[model samples]
Target: MQNRSLRADDWAAEALRKYSDMVYRLAYAQVRNRTDADDIFQEVFIRLVKSSPEFESDEHMKAWLIRVTVNCSKTMWLSSWKKRMVFWEDKDLNRIPAEEAPAGNEALEEALDSLPVKMRRVIHLFYYEEMSVDEIAEALSEKPSTIRSQLTRARKLLRKKLIGEEAKRRVQG
Candidate 1:
């Protein structure tokens, strides 16, 4: 029993180390608050440790984490306490690493931030997670067509925002 427990601990630690950033980023993208994102991150790992679920592959595990994170975000939004509370907008919340951004463009990050939560999630999963439309649909519990439509709309909106920003800069310059 002691040996079993040690193995479990080691597995949990390895899982945390491997997936912490992905979980935190997804939670942060959904909640848009560091504290809440931290809470959701803990909650996700807690569920993983408690469940000790078997996975077919690393991809399966990643998909499971994405589903849990999305569900937790939804639950957070639905909670009465969350509904009543005022959100303090964190300016730096959307500042991802340079490599994550398109050419490390601040304008693209700002445009992504301006998107609705649903569209933003689709964009993040599709681009950052490199999930296919079917994978995103499965993880998000949406139809593939819906995911595709959201991707299309998000791309158009992003393009418009980026183009508009560029035109404004050119005019001012």
Candidate 2:
């Protein structure tokens, strides 16, 4: 019994260390606020601890965590108190290595902010997380075709928004 308990504890620690950043990033992507993302992060892990469900594999566990994070994000977003609040910060994207960031990173971020939440989530999972459409679909419990369409629409919206931003800048200058 003691050995089984220790093994479970070790598994939880390992899982946390392996997936915390991914969980946090997914949360941040959904909510677009540091504080809300942190809250979602804590809530996701708390749910994980409370449920203690057995996973068939690592991929299954990851998908489970992502689904929970997305659900929690939606709940938080829909909360009455959250609707009345405005919290904005760009720190999460700043974690991208300078060399990896595009020359117009700020413009890209602004464009992303303008996208609908579903589009933003799909885009972030595809581009930032380097997930394929099928993987994103699995994680989000969405269809691959749906994920593909969302990615296509997101790219078009981003291009339109970025171009508008550039046009505005040129007019100002």
User: Number of the top candidate by lDDT?
Assistant: 2
TM-score of each: 0.80, 0.82
- Candidate 2 matches the true fold with a TM-score of 0.82
Top candidate, metric TM-score: 2
- Give the per-residue lDDT of model 2 (tens digit) for 1-173: 35333254477777888999999988878777677888899999889878998999998898899889989988988876744454456445434555766876888767878899899888878887798999999888889999999999999999999999999999999
Stretches of model 2 off by over 4 angstroms after superposition: 1-9, 85-104
Residue 8 accuracy (lDDT) in model 1? 43
- Model 2 shows how many backbone clashes? 0
Alpha-carbon runs more than 4 Å astray in model 1: 3-9, 80-104
